[model samples]
Structure formats: structure tokens, C-alpha cells
Target: MLIGIIAISFSSIFIKWSAAPVSVQGMYRLLFTSLLMLPFARPYTGAAAALRARDWLLLLFSGCMLALHFLLWMGSLSYTSVASSTMIMALEPVFIMLGAYIFYKEKTAAAAMLGMAVAIGGVVLIGWGDIGISPDNLKGDLLSIGGTAAVAVHLLVGQKLVIRMPSYLYSLIVFVAAAVVFAVYNLVMGISFFHYPSKEWGIFVLLAVVPTVFGHILFNWLLQYVSATTVSMNILGEPVGASILAFLLLGEQLKVLQWAGGLLVMLGLGVYLYTGRKKTAQSETALPSAS
Candidate 1:
């Protein structure tokens, strides 16, 4: 999980390094990842065959959400500081919490609700600060939040389906769907695909190998061992790691408001996750024990 966090921490930095259009960059990242996984896909054929048509459709929907996430979050890097963009991404848990309540009939605890409010308030603070700096900054912040929500939906769907399929097989299906979405999007929008410099392609590959392969895949794999809360708390490291990387590599610095907002976000999310987990545990303990 730590390695996964560290690998994903470089995502924004790589996106910053590229000059390709956001859709193009996203397209190639997924495309390269899909290509790299082709050899392993053969092994997962049995798992793939076990999935019904409904499962395939769910995977496709999840992939669409994933594509939306990449497009918005990657696009946000154009207008906002890495600090602000990544901080907004940190709100994924709250979105996921809401998803559980709506889709799975999970009851949210009061403290968790408070935490969600505080966390969103913090992002709102950051967005307000960005508006003072530049409207474009606010635009980037909104895009980042949208990306967060999209990814939460993707995860919610995955939570149900991963039980029935191999993680790599599920990932390959989603990646292929996402890559196809980007391909069609770019083609319709008349964006160039093969014209990027070697540097751009290199960043694309790093995005594929680092964040996609090592980061997210490892997280999916680790879920078999750790509680979801443990995994989520570790993910909070990304904003800090990404911010530090941006400062060192890109020389991006945060303002007082940014720092304050980020602290609130981290604290609120920490409280939200742990409190919710506690409530879940208390309920589980009260119920009849499983034999």
C-alpha cells in the first residue's frame, strides 16, 4: 500500500511534464497499459468467461467513469496548482461514502456526516481561494472534484464485481473500455494522437507503468489483505507526496490558504473514515456472529 501510494504520488507530476492534450495523454496511457497487459490477459480468459453479459456492461460503465475521471483530473492540472488539484482528489472517500449509502443501504454515522461536511468545506475554502487568484484556478479545482466523484462511482461498481473476476482481468476490461472511449472522443473532437514528441510518449508510459500498473493494481491486490479503511488512510498520502514532488520537481509552492484547507481535508477525511469504520464494527459485533 505504501508503494502504491508513492507510485501514484507521481501522477500529477507526470501529467505536468506532458504537453499533449489531456484526452490524448489519457488515451495513450490507457492504450499503453492495455498493450502491456495483453500477455497476461490470456491467463485470465477463464475469469473473463465466467462473467455474464451484465458484468461486462457494468465493467464498461465503470470504464466510462474511469475515463471521465482521467479527463477531468488531468485537465485540471492545466489551470490549478498541483496542491489544489490533488487535494480535491483526496475527497474520493466522502464521495464513496455517499455512494455506499445510496447504492448499498449502508447507514452513515453522524460523526462521519460531520467529517464529510468538514472535508468538503475545506475543498470549498481552497476553491474560494483559487477564485481570488484566478477564475481558471477555480475551474481546475472544480474539474478535480468532478474527477474525484467519477472515480468514486468507478470504485463503487468495482466493489461489487471484483469478487467474481480476477483483478487483472477486470482491470484489463476496464482499461480497454476506457481506451476505446478516449479514442472515440478524440476522433470525434478531431484531436491528434500520434504527433506527440518522445518526451510526451515517455510520460504517457510512466503514467501507465507507475500509477496505473503499480499504484492502482497494487491497491486492488492489497484489498484482499487489509481493511478498506487502512487502504484509504494510506491513500491520503498522495496529496502530500504529490505536493512535495511538485515543489521539488516543478517548484510549485502552496499558499497559506492552501495549506490550511489541505489540513482540514486530511483531518476530516481521517475522522470520517475511522468513525465510519467504528460504527460499522459496532454494528457487526452486535449482529449474530457468522459461523
Candidate 2:
């Protein structure tokens, strides 16, 4: 899970590194990632036979959401600071919590709520420092928020379907579907998919393989051993990791307030994990003895 978090933490950096338009970048990233997984997932044959009509429909919806998430998130980079965008994007777990409660009937504990509040506070601080209330940044922020919401929906839908399919297969289908959506979007927007320089293509390939494939595979693997809440908590580390990387690689700097906000976010996430574990332990103990 830690490695997955770290690998996904590099997503924004790689997205920024690519010179292609947002739609094209998203299309190629998913296309390459799906192609790389074809041998293992075998989506065209065995996996296809395994999936029911409903599963395919759900996967298609999830793929559309994924494509929208990428489009908004990648586009936000042009108009907003990376720090603000990443901090906002980290709120995805919060949206997931809401979705779990509303759609899955999952009980959210008090500690989790508190942690979310603290994390939002941290996000606000980061945004205040990195984002101005200018029209452009506001548009970017709105798009970022929309991207976060789309991903939350994607995960909620994916959690149900993934139980029926192998993680790689699920990812493969979603990526192929998303690639088709992005390809059409790029065409409509007049974006040249093949115009990027070789260096940018190299970065795009790395983005597809590293963050999309390896990161997601590691995350899915961890789900076998850990609670969903635990996985969500771990994902809160992405903004922190991304921010640090942005500073080192992109020469991006944050104010002291922003740094303090990052600390607060981490502290809140720690509290969430601690309290969640305690609750899980208590629940385990509360299970009645069987015959």
C-alpha cells in the first residue's frame, strides 16, 4: 500500500511532464496501460466470457467516470498551482467515505468524520496559499473538485464489480473503455495525439506503466489484506508525497502556512487510522460465540 501510494503520488508530476493535450494524454496513458495488461488480463477472451451484461455496463460507466476524472484533473494543472490541485484532489477519500455511507450503508465513525474535517481544513490552507481567487484558478479548482467527485463515484462502482473479476481484468476493461472515450474527446477538441516529442512520450509511457499499472495493482493487492477504510487513509498521503515531489522536481514551493496545512492533514489521517483500528478490534471482540 505504501509503495502504491508513492507510485500514484507521482501521477501529477508525470501529467505535468507530458506536453500532449489533456485528452490525448489521458487516452494514450490508459491505452498503453490496457495494452500492457492484455496478456495477463486477457480481457478479449476469458475475462469477457466471465463478465455479465450488468458488469460490463457498470465497468463502462466506471470507465467514463475515470476518463472525466483524468480530463478535469489534467486540465486543472494549466490554470492552478500543483499544490492546490493536489491538495484538493486528495479529498477523493472524503468523497469515497460519503459514497460508502450513502450507497453501501457503511457506518462512518466519529473519528473518521473528525479526520475528514481536519483534512478539509488542511486543504483549505493549502488552497489559500497556492490558489488565488482569480477567475482562472477558481475554474481550475472547480474542475479539480469535479474530478475528485468523479473518482469517488468510480471507486464506489468499481468496489462492487471488482469482487466478481480479477483486479487486473477489471482495470483492463475500464482502461480500454476510458481510452475510447478519450480518443473521441481528443478528436472533437482537435488535439493531435501523435504530435508529442519523444521525451514526452517516454514520460507518458512511464506514467501508464508506473502509476496506473503498478500503483493500482499494489493497491488492489492490499485490499485483500486490509480494510477499505485503511486503504483510504493511506491514500491521504498522496498530496503530501506529491507536494514534496513537486517541490523537488518542479521547483514548486509552498508557504509556511501551506506546510503547516500538510502537517495537519497527516495528523488528521493518523488519527483516523488509529481510531478505525480500535473500532475494528472492538467489533471483533463483540462477535458472539458460536456453537
- Model 2, 1-291: lDDT tens digits are 668878988988998887778888789889999888878754447767978999989999999999999999889988887888877887887788877888888887887779867876776676577888999999989999999889778777777876777766777888999999999988888888787789988887888988888776566555555545456667677787888889999998877887888788788887877787788788778886531
Backbone clash pairs for candidate 2 read none
Give the alpha carbon lDDT tens digit for every residue of 188-226 in model 1: 999997987889889999999999898877876654544
TM-score of 2: 0.91
Every model's TM-score: 0.84, 0.91
| Model 1 segments more than 4 A misplaced | 108-133, 222-234, 256-290
For model 1, the local distance difference test gives: 0.80
TM-score of 1: 0.84
How much is the lDDT of residue 269 in candidate 2?
Answer: 81
